[model samples]
Target: MLDDFMTRATLAGVGTALAAAPLGCFVVWRRMAYFGDATAHAAILGVALSLAFSMPIFVGAMIVALVMAAAVTLLTGRGYAMDTLLGVMAHSALAFGLVAVSFLSGVRIDLMAYLFGDILSVSHVDLAVIWGGALLVVALVAWRWSALLTATLNPDLARAAGIDPRREQLVLTLALAVVVAVAIKVVGVLLITAMLIIPAATARPFARTPEAMAAFAVVLAMVAAWIGLQTSYQFDTPTGPTIVCVVAVMFAVSSIASTLRRAG
Candidate 1:
């Protein structure tokens, strides 16, 4: 039974890593770390809503994430600094979510689980949700990969080519919403951004092109997930943070290697 549980956990972790890897590339490319954080932080509000409504936690989280994305897009369209707006929304949503969760009369919510995740507890149903959401996100991204890349690399160029940058931004935001919803269970709100950023950041040093970078990021994320899981098992530590720490270590190593290569 122990082995079975570990196997299941490992599979779930890999699936999450695969899904996060590609989207994470876009997050890094566009410098959307703050946006990712804002979306993930708003997930706490989704958790609160799920508890209150007795809905699936992922559903609540996805809805709130999409709403937050829309709000951010609108705010930015009105000329607000994206980082500043994201920061405000991130902290405000987190605070409101905490307060909202506290108002529940019965059934105490595990704060740690929402913040840092409880990967070992992922059910078969949860796996289905993760994979399904991931497929949709990957499909959407693949279908629009060129346009998205063009918009990210040069919005003016994409616009001149008749690709609406605003529309692509919306698509990216929606993709991010799905990613946050699926990943919340794997890495929780606090570490989800790390999963999205670190792998892509690490891959940057090795990639010769944007496509290679994205693919490398996915591979790194998967490796990190496996190594982190093994380490968690060996050390009897929390899986989500452990995985994030592994990804961080990979980023550090990649940074050093990149610096040395440049120097040499």
Candidate 2:
């Protein structure tokens, strides 16, 4: 039987994988990997706010992430290069969050844990929060899948079809925020975007359809989480980064195999 901590940690990691994988399909399709990083970075600032005000960390992270996503969407679409905007926003949020967390008084914060994740140390309450946020994201994405795919393919087409592309974008944005909030516990701020993007990228070669890519991404992510946990346990490495490293390796292997298949 798994110990309680191991069980909670497993659940936390798996739940995070479940939410991040499918939504990450949209992130990959939209070429919004940097945007995801921006939101995840903003989550660190949310942590500061939550710690300072004694609020729930999940709530704080979600609110700040949503605001950041909205701000980027509003500011970047008018003649600005979104890639540049997202890069600026992502790094700026991380820097500001680190500085702000340093200034918090009274309560001590685990800087490294928030930066690199402390999955093995996750509490039962944190487990509940993680699963809750993950499910909400999954449900939101499932509900809007068709509309989102259409908008992602062509916003003008979506508009002509009477679908408001912006609304679908907002739905994705909301789901992303929730995923970032919950993922902070499993993979921390710096590595959270990798958890979203890598598995999806790895699955891309094997998947003919968006749905297949998403399913494969989820499966790959779950495997990474489990293997990463075991690897970290055996080597006494950092859990979150360990998971990301495993995912990165998988991506490398997939890329190589895909290239060889194409060559043949």
Candidate 3:
């Protein structure tokens, strides 16, 4: 089954969705959408550095993403607006990454692949990385689920219960970096946060509990991945953006249904 490129691509997409949906729940709950973008955008710089240093792209992306996430976490609430901080760092990192990539002489790199993804060309090694990273993220999030929830819902309450909200934030920061590293291959940097945000957002209107929301987001995400791959194959459209488009459509439908249900 993995012999086929399509099979590999589908599995990669599903793996990415698996990891992204649950973490995306935290992202939505914490209103860390911009934070996600910043981490993802910084991944381009990682790609450049990886090519320059001749290391694995995953290692470079992971290292740079961790650094970016840590920087954002550290600088948050240090006398600047969150959006402003993210906007500055996010665009600057992307601009710098593009420039850095341009400076790598004799290397014919496809910026579009890193920016928008090249999922249809995924290989067995890629599958291993995607699923391995996905499972690791799932385990990490599950292990910290209760503590993370407590911190998110009420930091003071979490403190009263002996859970440090800062620690939980670090857990999320680490997880976000991992997701960005793994997903850079699947959806690329530009659209990684979309995969993270859309599934969780689409699942929100129907889920009454955090667990339910995460599960629904996973299902919605996998379905979007499958449908998006199929649609892209059928229409010869871009795979990464197509997957995001499908999820966005799901989000719109879910939102409309939720609105009608509430109205009725």
Q: lDDT values of the candidates? A: 0.90, 0.92, 0.95
Clashing pairs in 3: none
How do the residues 105-146 of candidate 2 rate in per-residue lDDT, one tens digit apiece?
888888999989999998988988988888898888888888
Cα lDDT tens digits for candidate 1, 93-141? 9999999999998867889988998888888888888888888888998
**Cα misplacement distance, residue 188 of candidate 1 (Å):** 0.5
Candidate 1 Cα errors over 4 Å, as ranges = 1-3, 77-79
Among all windows of 10 consecutive residues in model 2, the one with the lowest summed lDDT is 1-10
Task: Show the colliding residue pairs in model 2.
Answer: none
- The weakest ten consecutive residues by lDDT in model 3 span 121-130
> How many clashes (backbone atoms < 3 Å, residues ≥3 apart in a chain or on different chains) does model 2 have?
0
**Candidate No. with top TM-score:** 3
Ranking by TM-score: 3, 2, 1
lDDT of 3 by residue, 102-132 (tens): 9999998999999999999888887898899
Candidate 2 — which residues are off by over 4 angstroms?
1-3
Q: Which prediction has more favorable lDDT, 1 or 2?
A: 2
Query: Against the true structure, candidate 2 has what lDDT?
Result: 0.92
Model 2 TM-score, 2 decimals: 0.97
